[model samples]
Target: MKELMKGNEAFAEAAIRAGCRFFAGYPITPQSEVLEYLSRRMPEVGGVFIQSESELAGISMVYGAAAAGFRAMTSSSGPGYSLLQEGISYIASAELPCVVMDVMRYGSGLGDIFTGQSDYWQAVYNGGHGDYRTIVYAPSSVQEMADLTVMAFGKAEERRNPVTILSDASISQMMAPVELPAMACHDPDAPAWALKGKGNGHFKRHTSVMYYMNEYDGYVRAKYEKIEKEDQRWESLETEDAEIVLVAYGISSRICEEAMRSARAQGRRVGLIRPISLYPYPVNAFDGLAPRAFLSVEMSALGQMARDVALACGMRAPVYSMLGGTRLYSCSDVEARIGEILGAAHGAF
Candidate 1:
């Protein structure tokens, strides 16, 4: 059965279904609903939910709960997400499993509560001080909010690292029908490294000291390599013999798809590549493609994802950007940009 749900609430409900027994987070616009939903739902499921005094405190609580072998999660928007960096670094260093969500809002320093995709660099590049990487998922729809939240918890445990759901204000607040996953239970004693009480003297857990070990470098390298090789995910549309391919994710990709369809209807060879995973970056999606140009569509003024597209395709062709700084542009706007790029390629002005 599908229920009409908002993206934030869907994500929260899905977390509980995925066995997320502990949640700690502060209220922030565009994502506060996540905390609110979990607060009421957690106790009903016999789980724990805490509305921490601050984002820092919330993430710290998540770290402690995750270390105890429980499925834990936290969420916030840009500013609050910034505060979790230190705790996220600590969790990464400890190799603990947890999930985090960034309901991105616009701007750099205290950007307004408008929709934005400007956090691409921060989330993918690890804003915290560390030699670490967190898996990032960019969802374009409300259904994905539910689906990916469930997958994130599993992936976090699988990799023993934090996984991030990178959503924008549009997706977070939009209402759509979603068929959520079934409820699952997680055992707190499942992980060998969990901090059990004194009765378990044989197994001890140490965190944030991996750098001191001789093999730390090799271990970290291998882990990320495997993830990069096997975890890259994307959705390619009509790229078989396309001369132009548009790359985007989240709400931006939704608009790009519309543009691609419009361009194709007019007999233009346009395609789209929607990245599902942002960190590994879905570089494999570019394999065996030889388009004349690549266009990066984003909601940031700087075209933050354009560079990654260039790197993935090895600059085989020119990469263009259709940027929407603080708001979404129409499909016709994207089509106009494509026209400009095509005209420039043909030296038509």
Candidate 2:
């Protein structure tokens, strides 16, 4: 059944349903409600909720708990997310399974307590260091907040890597009616490769790389290659004969959906393709769609996905973008752009 709730409330419920037993976080604007709600709910379900001193410490605590085979998570805004990147990198290198919510707010440096997609580049492209990649799940609404929370944990455990439920404060603070799925108890054993302790001294320990060598590079490469094969999801609408395709993710995609509907009302044949998972990008989906013109709409200033889409779809489809270090455009602004692009491209098709 669905309930009318804030995005933060849905986020907490989803985590609980995903069998998250441990949550550690530092309160920050836009995302504190997630911590507050989980602080109460986690304990009621015989789980753990810890409010740490800083985002750095909070993520470390999550790393520790996840290492012990408990589903765990942490939430923060742009600044706090930056603080946690170091811990996130360590969690990546250690191959620990965990989820992080980045309810992004405006900022290159102290942007403010407002909504912004500035963290798009950081979340998917590596804010901390190294070649590590985290599965980034962008949810546009309250329902996605909860649904993506569960999906994030499952992806993290499956990949033995970090996963992020990336969103802007607009989404975090917004209230919407969201139909939640039936809550299911988390199954720790659902993941096959979950590091489950030393196993009664009968198995070798899963240790972080202490000694780096050429072979380790190859080993990491193989793991990433396997990840590319296994992890990928992108949703589409009416692309069977679409000449112009709109590519968006997270909240921007939600906006794009509204834009698409309006454009259709005006007799445009535009469509939208939403990438549910950003790290293992759906390159094949891009290829299969094969639209004449592709445009990207998002909340960041021309970040990771746009470039990734270009590479996958090739220059055959010219790409236009309307995202940056500025405010996100509205449904009208995006609809007009997509309408123009689709109209121009439709002529050629």
Candidate 2 structure quality by residue, lDDT tens digits, 1-349:
5688888889888888888999999998989998889878988999999999999899999987877778989999988999989988988888888999899887777778877777878887879988688888888788878888888887888788899888887778888988775666775555443456656755534446535445778788888788777777778876667767888886778788888888777767778888877777777677666677788877766454688778868777798877755666899999777766766765632
lDDT of 1 at 8: 96
| Model 2 TM | 0.89
By summed lDDT, the worst window of 10 consecutive residues in model 1 runs over: 200-209
lDDT of 1 by residue, 1-349 (tens): 9999999999999999999999999998989999889889999999999999999999999999998999999999999999999999999999999999999999988898989999999899998997999999999999998999999998998998999999999899999999999998889998876887759467566588585688988989999999999999889999878889999999899999999999999999999999999988999999999988999999999989999999999999999888988667889999999989988887872
| CA lDDT, every model vs. true structure | 0.92, 0.80
Q: Look at candidate 2 and give me any clashing residue pairs.
A: 2-179, 300-323, 300-324, 301-324
Total residue pair clashes for candidate 1: 0
Q: How high is each candidate's TM-score?
A: 0.97, 0.89
Q: Give lDDT for model 2.
A: 0.80
Model 2 residue 130 CA deviation in Å: 2.0
